[model samples]
Target: MSEKRALPWLDSPPDGFLEREQRIKSQKQVNIDVYGILRTKDVPQISFEVVGSTGNIYRTIIGNVPFCDCPDVRFRKVQCKHMCFVLSAMDVPSELRYQRSFLPSELREMLATLSLKRKLDTTTPTTAGEKKPVDGECPICFNDFKPKQKTTWCQDCGSNFHQGCFEKWRAAIQTSDNAVRCLYCKLPWKGDEPETPRPTPKAVEPEQRRSKMKYPNVGDN
Candidate 1:
């Protein structure tokens, strides 16, 4: 849980980074999940769109080298989470994916799986009362709770926080005895498996995705 929004890069290794940096990057990559990554439609390929941990979307472009629009990527010029996502979607083996060259792809099969599955299915939260957490608003970030985003709950106080905000709060108390206390109640909070946001009222994934995906293979283009 790190509250540092202007935070340092997690799993990103700088260009020509050393072995120690590589090891550290690999370890942190585990904590970050690739939400969704799509191959852009421009000629010779342009970039990939990735849904980030904070429930925001970012762009990852493969140029003379790999790059992401996130602050960490721009400032550090390292293989940030968004690039990790782009590489992961390409099905590049873990060892190869770290290199900038491997981030770009001509593989359509891999692209298909990620096309519309935006957002990580990390955790769904309980909102207290009868309404589902997704139905109510989050206590922090002030954004409406979305089923697609990772969410957390406090059983004691029945308050819910988005995953990013939850981790941010947890970071704030790291120096104190209560690491994961409820911000509202100061009660220690327990961790639980996260739930994905429920499908929207229409719930039309299977039919829609299949219809939209018309290309037969990478060679088709």
Candidate 2:
């Protein structure tokens, strides 16, 4: 009888595994964006369409057996940048990111967290003019603002949020009217005015210019 393959998640990762994963994450050039997320009804698996740095789209699955179709994973048999992007974007913990498998309960918790975030993203804030202290977690991502991180303040409410998080929140709640409003105060965002094309200057006719002149030039005769 053939022996069963051991689960990778059960064993400790190889030496330098974490350092290598960190290196991949720190690479800004390996840009990635999630196109969409798919969840299986019967299976505990979740799939993501991740756009990679080279503009190629790859399928990444997180569940009993984590998988990524990127060349780095298929050939090297190691975690790839696309996998790192998906996990990091979802704010998955560092300990779980390296795991090759996840329990059903873990997947459920992740999905629940994501669902709550989506709800928060789409729901407009009703409370207006209530200024939240600058030190708390951002209402959008629910993450604490780090020092030196780019940030923006609500003009009316005086609430502060990470600039990137605020932008995402603004985008999610944008209306057909093209109005950008403060997330907390629900008032029109002062500095985020929509760009309008500058009006073209009208040309003045020579006759009109001459008519308006207080004194006619002698050379005009």
In terms of TM-score, the best-performing candidate is 2
Candidate 2 residue pairs in backbone clash? none
Each candidate's lDDT (Cα)?
Answer: 0.44, 0.53
Give lDDT tens digits, candidate 2, residues 161-183.
67765554443233112456655
Q: Any residue pairs clashing in model 1, and if so which?
A: 123-194, 123-195, 124-195, 147-197
Candidate 1 deviant stretches above 4 angstroms? 1-46, 62-64, 103-221
> Candidate 1, after superposition: displacement of residue 102 in Å?
3.8
- What's the lDDT for candidate 2? 0.53
Q: After superposition, how far is residue 166 of candidate 1 from its true place, in Å?
A: 18
TM-score of 1: 0.31
For all predicted structures, in order, the TM-scores are: 0.31, 0.49
Report, for all candidates in order, the number of backbone clashes. 4, 0
* Model 2 weakest 10-residue run by lDDT: 211-220
